[model samples]
Target: MQFLPVVQRIVADRWPWPRSFPRSLSMVRSLVLGVMSLFGSVAVAADWPGFRGTGDSVATGQYPTKWTATEGIAWTVNLPGYGQSAPVIWGGTVYVTAVDGAQREKGFVLALDAKTGKEQWRHALEPTQKAKWSETVSRAAPTPCADADGVYCFFEGGNLLALTHAGKVRWERSLVRDYGEFQGGHGVGSSPAQTADTLFILIDDRGPSYLLAVEKQTGKTRWKTDREARGGWSSPVVATRNGKPEIIASSAGTIIGYAADSGKPLWKLDNVVGNTIPSASVSGDRILFGGGTSRSKDAPPMGAKGNGCLRLIDADGKPGYESVWSAKLGISNYATPLAYQQVAYFVNQVGIVTAHDLQSGQELFAERIDGPCWASMIGAGDYVYFFGKDGTTSVLKAGKEFEQIASNPLWAAKSKPKSAGNESRPGAGSEYGAGETVYGVAAADGAFFVRTGTRLFRIGQ
Candidate 1:
């Protein structure tokens, strides 16, 4: 272990010096304390219950700044099926959901041994309604939400269910059976947010768009608020505004915040760049919003397009929230923007990253990364982790300037580089769909978890 040498050095270097008996005893006391602390450090790491950890997107512990494919991996387990949903950690197990069959017909949930990467349990789910999604994305794109008692998973086919920590199905429901069909361009990609008593969901579709809060214990709808019937992939985030929690959902024309408990409309910031693909991140009363997609072939080049501005929105309560600052120079494309310390980060689909001041939205630095990232960035201590679509993990030093700490890949040794060789397809990048895809990442206690298309890996545990 990395700490073993440091413990030995501290206990041996200056302990048995030429000293008096009382001084020696004091040194012994310090040595005992040091060893005890070292033992405490060996305890099991923490848990990341949902997307962006606490549904707030703030990673709070010291994580490793450097690692490699073989060097720093604590464990790696192959997933049963392929899904883009990120892995959520709770209790001593990690939970993930994926779609099966060549048609992506089946959806399943898997629980893995957090320490050993062993399959503890697997539940092949029976969909309440058949799912239909575009070939561009998987059927199971929404990430799962995990808590102490159970984990809730949502599939693009309109299935939402709660299962106990031991993999027993507690409650299940189909959104399509209850609320007609999801009329969206990309099926369902929004992951639900879990609160103390409710499971909040953002259903943006062509038929009837609504935000609903479901009782966690029973599969009962608490409240449903209708929205402008439009489709988007952004996940709803629960943020406390003026000491009360509100759920914020971003779409093409509007970004609205609703009362979390009552599902009442609170505020709306309209005429955004639109075509929002990234989830909103909250910092205290300030919420960070980022770039949108034009979705038109005749549209301007993807650089901002009067759209790429990384907007720092401040909650103003009654009169509605105001855009405090907007960094248009460099902004997001697909990956969600991250606010680390006082700096806000945006990673676009083409691998470009920009860091900005949280308050002023002043550009700190603009740099290209190994990305084309779909997974949102997460920061721990002085290092921020970026998961690129090419299975590249670019570790950047968290600061005002650009400093790359290390870069690594998640592909196996025998895997060859696949080319997303066809550019004629819609939204296809030169490198898109050609190689391994890293969909999302999570961090807890001290370990970092990465979810690729077919695998889940725990590093620096």
Candidate 2:
């Protein structure tokens, strides 16, 4: 056999050394194997690094199916202030933002030991200025996004911040100063999306609203695009076209696609109507966009009063463009449409759930779900969970046909007596309500973390 330099040398050296004795390099070999196994374990239990768990809008984990205030609660902690943002879990920490009681716009990004539900750290940020037009209970509604290195938060008043896993401030920026001001009745509700290298924000403000990309490592502005504002609160999502990724966003007037790397507008569909708050969901090559009543000016005179359409954009061209079909389903303004396999599900503010065919805009089935819904529906395996504003969660099968599976109530506990001077504060009318309004629901590690008014409960086993 022709000698292959190193290979032949190694064979000759090993022939006399390993016949009846241990190799000297055996310890080194074991150490190398051990390091690889440790890396594999870390990769397996990946964190929910950002909003909607990995930007595909899929909450993946062995999340709990049935839960109540008392039952299936892994742990319950009384949050310091109030917020509507969902709890973001990363590694072993849980992070959320809230506005405290002194009329101060505070950011409470808490770190809880994911295993024991114990408090780790509470990082607070005093706002430069209090957020405007925020209802007492609805302030700080934007959720936090976390990665292995740090957690990020976006305040309603346009403050964006990054913190280390150990609770240290990494960087901060203000969207209003950097970009412009938002125009919604409520402030910014769109959560930021984090990718491997950049953090994306959908700033649909009143003046010069656009999609922005920032460097995740240093919080520096990477690229910004000033696109037409269709008046939306929907979060931007990353979708792949061909082999490249695109940032897809839906607003009141159009559904546009931008290059994720450069923030360039690729295509636009102007068939969508009304102010949009629902994020688009992608299934295979077809992207689904829905929700929003026609802006007060564009409302139809007859039939259902809202404008809803299921547009299928073909993702196989340089600038693929088309609206497969459009429908007049009156969906809720804030409820995002969810895609499950072949069918698409939508829940409106008035409590109606509609299922539509993915390919065509034909309605498959429609049914009325109890209570008004502001939180988007989440699909967990075979069941789609709908959390209503009135604190009732309705579970249904994810199918072309309608089916109500279970309805769990989170009614408030007995009202506590108010202190003597507490009644004089401004906007304290509903201080002691009878129901826990479910604003956002997130599933992770076999548990459903639900945010009511001031409490965050872990549901399911």
Candidate 3:
């Protein structure tokens, strides 16, 4: 009976309890020392802070490399509206964007429990102007960036708002009123990035474009620099070389870097064209970017069309920068390539997955999946998770050879999709959305979050 009470005290001491709760001295120390063993598998080493995880989109925690709709799914929740912006995870919370209502003007920012997929807070944003959303340009297409204090979201029609973790609005800004109309065939997809105290935003479109850095708390402009980039949906990334800040972006036929502190031009690589959709991924000093038209209709060769490159950035504030390698081997139009295992894996619009050597730019191997991919790939360690437009998630080994581990379908089993077609083969149509579409994906908090038209799924143990 004495040992029984002591055991009970130990169990109670394992977690926080009221003052009246008893604790055994040895038991508390034992439980405290075993913290990592108790929760290591369920913990995320770092936050998925922005459009891409920590700006570059590479993950360190163990995420699910394979899962199906009715198989390894942890939880699923319906969203207010449809979007293509990937989810961002911070601590125990996951944040995503959407637009509600018939007019589709109701922009919303949602906070959910990262582990349970439970709804935490839903903050709806008021748009400055009525949004005109299309299949190509989604209303809530730009993924939000989050920090320790707040989450910042930008919607189509240039509506921007920052919300605290508890769903309180901190500040709001209008990109449309501040910068003018977003004139283009498609709308904005430039998500926000952050330095220590400044938030960096790049708006590159047919209308006036600029890169603006704003103070985090008040949303006041720190620096505003004009940009010549027209019609790009890629998000900006923040990195540092030799303790200085560099905000890098790939858009409008160039890979440009800006001084994060003063919003001044640091360097640029011109002659890069057709890379507009997916945000560039980074690995240490190198940035990998790729995108282009997958379907040109009846029109044939418009010169040699290929949009992909691996460019190394000079982090030391040096003026010179060079491409580590350039090739048409692994160029993705919408889906962003994931850099893993020292190779950049690019998935073209029609499901052509290519892995190119990061150091040499030589084509390693290519494979065809069951569908086209709209969302960018996210990697954790040796495994990469690829989301297809038809709600399929293909798990692959991040190796030189093409090795597919699993082909997991996302939609309900009742929904049937045709076998993936070959883009190079004749009589094949590579149109997108073959079934229920999966638009965005993220990996954090020991789980993978997938975004469908109107739902989000958390996949892990």
Candidate 4:
């Protein structure tokens, strides 16, 4: 008779039927506990997680601004192979990718002690067929994405892999096989983004380009949408508009927004230049996008043919969207535009930096700073660091006008030109005038991690 009251309470609580009641209840409880554990892990510390630091595209940690090879260097470990991907710092580990000499593709999600740069564990993915079209210096440029659960790395050959924090393989998927061919001359280079339970990637190649969402825990496809435009190399960023998160992506000729859960296209802005390589940066509700001409010949007239423009897309609209204003002056060829406070800065490969008013698409200041920039700009407390191809690093003030702080040189001692096929053939002749040849830069823990030709340097004060 005493048990009757408990049974009644269970019935009133709408518990499942007795046919499988107890077993099902225990399963449900297990799931709930698992989810809680995952949440607890993610809350431990603030990790980089993805390509552009957090989803906001701002690298805001206690990073240092001024340093030399010996000044602020924390620890520099020689990477086993070579990679052009930026190092993704998570919790206490730094994950990066690399390739072997035989072109037998290998990926490494390295866990480095956050403080001392000590090797924690190196998780290697199954070897893949190397991409022939990819430049030797630009092999597998896709950066790793990590959270509390695991770190995800994408290869140029279309392999998506997941590794646990302790160097265990979680799950892996081949994009080229499951999805389709990525048709770019350089192969797939865009990094994947992670939300609550989804891993989103922009697979824009020559074939049918698409934005794919996979279950973060199991590597299962959640939803994949074939993008309307052709594929480019820019990664996608999650934006919050009207209290809702939207995955904002720029492809060949359009910038689009899709629901984070479902793969539905929420809104799109056409007439955008195709082959865009810069990721979208969000400042409040306005999304800033700019790029150069798709065709190589059109490079001469960048903004003239409408190939480059700074577009401000209003993310508050219902099923549609409108551009607040667009200007031709703020277009970037390869580097993504950086927005700090109210000013958005744009820099092209040819070394032109333009400052624009975020509210109004007005060009506040435009000046030619340096030439041939391939690396993305990183803004620390008060300085914007620009690494040029000629091995020169220029430090400038982040303001309306150009203010050069310091110009440092990165000269390699070797002068032999090494062939791509044979590492011993020779070095690249001279490094004094080779520009910076920098690919990516990240700021964290008060030190700047700069990825040069074959080394990762910790530069800062």
Model 2: how far residue 151 lies from native, Å: 1.2
* Count of clashes, each model: 3, 4, 1, 23
* Candidate number of the best lDDT: 1
Clash count for candidate 1 is 3
TM-score-sorted candidate list, best first: 1, 3, 2, 4
Local accuracy of candidate 2 as per-residue lDDT tens digits, 100-202: 7555457677877665567788878776546443342236677777766688888866788889989899999887677666655345667776565677888
Clashing pairs in 2: 62-446, 63-446, 332-348, 332-349
Task: State the lDDT of candidate 3 residue by residue for 1-461, as single tens digits.
Answer: 00011111111100122123327777555444433322222334557777766655667767766665566777767677666677888777989887766556788888888877678878876677665555544557778877777788877657777788899999998978887877754556667876656777788877788898887788878889998847677778765443355788877667787877787787877756566666666665567777564333455344333455544444565644666666666767666667776777887656888888766788998889776677767777678777776777788887788888888876545433244321111111112233456767777767777776666777776
Which stretches of candidate 1 lie above 4 Å from their native place? 1-45, 131-134, 296-319, 412-434
Question: What C-alpha lDDT, on a 0 to 100 scale, does residue 320 get in candidate 4?
Answer: 53
- List model 1 lDDT by residue over 279-375, tens digit each: 7777654577776445556655433332322232344436257566776766666777787777788876567888887768788998998767777
Error of 1 at 51 (Å): 1.1
Please estimate how well model 4 matches the true structure, expressed as its whole-model Cα lDDT.
Answer: 0.61
lDDT of 4 by residue, 216-276 (tens): 7899998999865454677887765433457888756677889877989988766676335
